[model samples]
Target: MTHHTDLLIIGAGILGLSHAYAAAKRGLKVKVFERTATPLGASVRNFGQALVTGQPPGPMLDLARQSRDIWGQWAQLANLQLKRNGSYLFARTEAEEHLLEAFCAGRAEEYGYRVNLLQGAAMNDLYGGQFRHHRAALHGLDDQQLYSREALPALINYLCRELKVEFHFSTLVRDIEPGQLHSTAGSFRGEQIIVCSGHDYQTLLAEQIAELNPQICHLQMLRARPKVDLNLQHALLTGLSCVHYGAFADLPEAAPVQAQILRDVPHLHEHGIHLLISPTPYGELIIGDSHHYGSDPSPFNAEQVDNWMIELAEQTLGCQIQVVERWQGVYGSRGPGPFSFLRAADGVSVALMHTGVGMSVGPAMAERNITELWGEV
Candidate 1:
């Protein structure tokens, strides 16, 4: 059978869904095709942190803020369990503190951010004195989180029921030419075709993706059920994050912080280990993550990486955590940018390499793309 629509979106991750939502809202007949039976990719396998504050200044940061606002607005319509808990980046060393101070001072006004340097009483109040780690912290008041497991399904439902967008699951696209997409199920034709294939580069546009030579970043993440209710007030980050996130890298103090990490925790620097803990509404904590980048990464999760992450979590949070679940995610990375959008053919656009900020910037990117394609929507 042949199906036709105004806009056809490939890949059902956050990026695809965002485009579908934008197009449908603009009264376009939209059909989405997913290669898998269900949504399982970097979009779902993440901390679900819509971190706006950590994005480097300029268009990327603006896109994050816009996407965060869109997520908040859609949470009500989609009935998603969204948490606006913000984020606290704790500094365990003086060098880290210096980095945070420099970041807060340099970029706050330019980005219109609300960040404060916390110490003494202010620092203790973050998790009710649970983090008596003996150093300073930076509080970002704009960050937010959502339960991706819940939010993804809710979003798909909303798009189907309210916006009348059609979705075809378990459909693999074998070929794409001009305005038509040939898949295992059938041929889908549309006025415009957008491909949001995350890490499956070779499947769709092999030549272009290969030429770009994008690096694949595999991350290890885990979820632990706390013995008692931790009642975390915000998403927690560690000093290592200063070097990991791009927004902090440009600061003059970042080099010193990186040097300190290399000196004290050489293994962490070697494996790109950083600690980010987000407490779910159900009293369970989602912790992660280590970045291992290459063209082909090992399938096995490194036990030492897990141990390092858990150990850092316990040390920073000042509590013991028993991990209940562990998983890994692989995403496309091509240095510092919001995403890579390539025009494969006439009316055919490829969007990928979000670099792990899809949840934070996907919606805004979709909006911009839609407007570019059809204007004013």
Candidate 2:
């Protein structure tokens, strides 16, 4: 027997789920297949931050904003537990402080980032003097932070119960063509098929994605419990983030900041180490991460990397931290651009986010493609 639907989506990650929402709203029968028993993957293993302020500008930034709007709408519709979080990007060095100043002087405000430079007592009031050694902080007040782990499950519930979309869990797609998919559960046929399997380059679109010189990024992440009642008002970022995010990385002031980091701490630079601390709904702080990239990198994580990150977090927060958990996150490399939609000869399509910003940009990307295929939704 064969299962059928109007649209068949593979990989129930953010991209797939977003596509599902787009189609279902248009009154189309949609079915989604996931290899895992639940929605698990990059969609959950992140800061849950709608990182709108740091996008590289132009198309990518626009998509980030649009996706954020859709996320807000869905949060209300799905009753997702969400928080509107701003970010305090603290500067640890003189060059970094200058870069933050430059970022706030023109581009940040011009781009509607609403960045403000705060220092001394004003900064102290924000986080209760967490950053005693930091020079200054630039706060972007419009960023959105989702309860990443819970949002997916709630979204799944909304799709299944409210939207009437069908989900086939633990169903692996062994083969796929234009309108048919052979899976472990059985055969599925549809008028359209979309692949949003994230970094699974081996399973689908192997030839096409491989041709684009793709690489997988292995990042180290952890959760920690603070020793005291710490008020984490915003997502915490450090000087290193200035060079990591496109919004500030390209600024003239950032060049020296990047160079100074490379010259002073080559190890951090080599491992793509940057510190981001986001507070979970349960009040535990999620900290990370260091990026290691290659076709096939070491499966085992380096202990020293964890130690370095913990030590950095401890220093920045002005408190001791008890590390509760640790894990590695895998995502597709940002090859040439932020994301891509590849078309196969048989009219099938693969949508992949090159960076970990899928949670931030997935919905809008799906809306674009779905609208292109079947008109406005």
Q: What are the lDDT figures for the candidates, one per model?
A: 0.86, 0.86
Please give each candidate's TM-score: 0.97, 0.97
Error of 1 at 121 (Å): 1.1
Candidate 2's displacement at residue 108, Å, is 1.6
Weakest 10 consecutive residues of candidate 2 by summed lDDT? 123-132
RMSD of each: 1.3, 1.3
Output the TM-score of candidate 1: 0.97
Which stretches of model 2 miss by more than 4 angstroms?
Answer: none
Q: How much lDDT does candidate 1 score?
A: 0.86
Model 2: lDDT of residue 286: 89
Instruction: Please give, for residues 188-211, the per-residue lDDT of candidate 2 as tens digits.
Output: 889888998888889986888787
Error of 1 at 303 (Å): 0.5
